[model samples]
Target: MFAEHLSAFLTHPVTATVLLVIGIVGITLELLFFSSGLLAAAGVVGFALYFLGFYLAGFVGFGDLAVFGIGIVLLILELVVPSFGILSVLGAICLFGGVLMAAADPKQAGIMLGIALLVAIIAVAVAVKYFRHRGVWNRFILKEQLTTDKGFTASPDRAFLVGMQGTSITPLRPAGTAEIQGERVDVVTDGGFIPAGRTIVVVMVEGTRVVVREIFEQNS
Candidate 1:
């Protein structure tokens, strides 16, 4: 009796399409926008109603609902934790499988899935472009510029060290310490090994990186 009532209500093409659109939009907004989980909650409710309607219409069963719920949970986890795309992929697979299984016609399912995917992609692109500029997004993004004008310097200016002669104080298997101009400085060789006490010439000094070469090799 319940199934017959649900079928009557959902039998209208317009009604079913509206429900599907609502579900897709809600989920897309939840995933793309950070709304303190409010959007997520609304999305969950929308999807639950969608699945319930299908279940009552006899198009889907409890098994399909379970799969869909698991998929939603996985997606939520993807947002909460960094899974390196693993959880998101699994969630998408479970969601698609559940939707396919509940759909009576394969052609309709394919069309609906395609539409959902397209909408999701557009939503993500828009969010990435505009959302980061918003004030709320600033709380999550690092917007500070570390520059000399801001009194922020990663290392002292070593431009004067360029062209200076030095001796390797430690073996430089690409990187080691060197004594240059009566001061100890960290240095790196240009793909060459230099033993301790070997004479070296500072070839380049860029910020904190002091690049050097063997003095003997330069003459030879």
Candidate 2:
């Protein structure tokens, strides 16, 4: 009698709705807050409970459960490994397929899937807008800039090279090396190509960028 009642309860639409709500809330919180994996753990537990309910109600088989687990694993891998979005796409497909296959009713499954997708979208938007620089995403993106204040320099200051004359060591198809004051300096032409061995004058120096213009001689 107890077993029958339990099965009925697990299979009930109201119970399914409750489980869906719990799962969605758990996942949203997981994404929105950096809780040192506590929120993520709760989300995993909520999803596990959802699958367990379906399994006990005979709505999902072992194969469907395995697929769902694989999907979750792939999603986790997407966070750590950079597959250029292939893992994320595959994970979404697996998750959707598993959920749809586990449903006893197609209409109910569609509704539930749509709700879950909407919730996920909203949660992601909130996280991106408000918590962009604070969460797990920081691990994948570079948020620091190496500046002079940080004791980082791309090249030594070439400000003194401005207005200095030089000879092009190689054809400046916009950029090439030049011998200025006996020092080989990398330089770029002013939107014009200069042939090798041509006399050029440094017109501008901005940080590592040394701009030069070809010099033309006039017969007296």
Candidate 3:
């Protein structure tokens, strides 16, 4: 008795409509606004709930790999093909076919489509956030400089930091990694092995490398 009522409610257009609304809102916040990953997650959950509800009720199969596979192929064609609008036609065909096959029940199908849109929005948001904040550069997400690229600005000479006093955080066995004043650097020595947690002074900064000398004597 309870299970039948649940299925009937799941098939309700109003329930599916509410799910669609959630998906739309999630997508909107993700794409048009700067945000964290939470809003997008909410959107995905909203959609996923709908998909599961419909699939269990025999609406359509979200778990169908063939439908997904066809969609992917269409996506590939859209990227690689060079006709006037053949890619768009193929892509649309694939989408419609996959969607139609998965939608065994009209109400369930609607819910799954709604959720898919929501998932897309969240994916875009994550992609943008990851690319925007990463140290390395990617062309798609990096539209403008969020801030001035302030990092190890490379120089062409060795006399830049020749007199800066520093210490090695890592053992520099003539040629190893080290840090000076919380700034990590690749350094070499005069064939002298220096252990980590020791004091050294920068004698040269040549192109991506720094040369250091151990300091044992201090004015008292």
Compare the candidates by TM-score and give the number of the best one: 2
Specify the highest-lDDT model's number: 2
By summed lDDT, the worst window of 10 consecutive residues in model 1 runs over 11-20
Question: Which residue pairs show collisions in model 1?
Answer: none
In order, the Cα lDDT scores of the candidates are: 0.75, 0.76, 0.60
Off by over 4 Å in 3: 62-101, 105-220
List the candidates ranked by lDDT, beginning with the highest: 2, 1, 3
TM-score of each: 0.60, 0.61, 0.34
How are the candidates ranked when ordered by TM-score, highest leading? 2, 1, 3
* Superposition error at 195 for model 2 (Å): 20
The TM-score obtained by model 2 is 0.61
In candidate 2 the C-alpha lDDT for residue 6 amounts to 71
How does model 1 fare in lDDT?
0.75
Off by over 4 Å in 2: 1-6, 21-39, 135-142, 161-220
* Model 1 TM-score, 2 decimals: 0.60
The sequence of per-residue lDDT tens digits that candidate 1 reaches over residues 1-220 is: 8677776676344455555555665655565565777766766765565566667767897788788878888988978884766887788688778777776775787676677667656755676677655423455688789987998867689999999999999999999999999999999998899999999999998779999998875554
Candidates' RMSD to native: 6.0, 5.4, 13.2
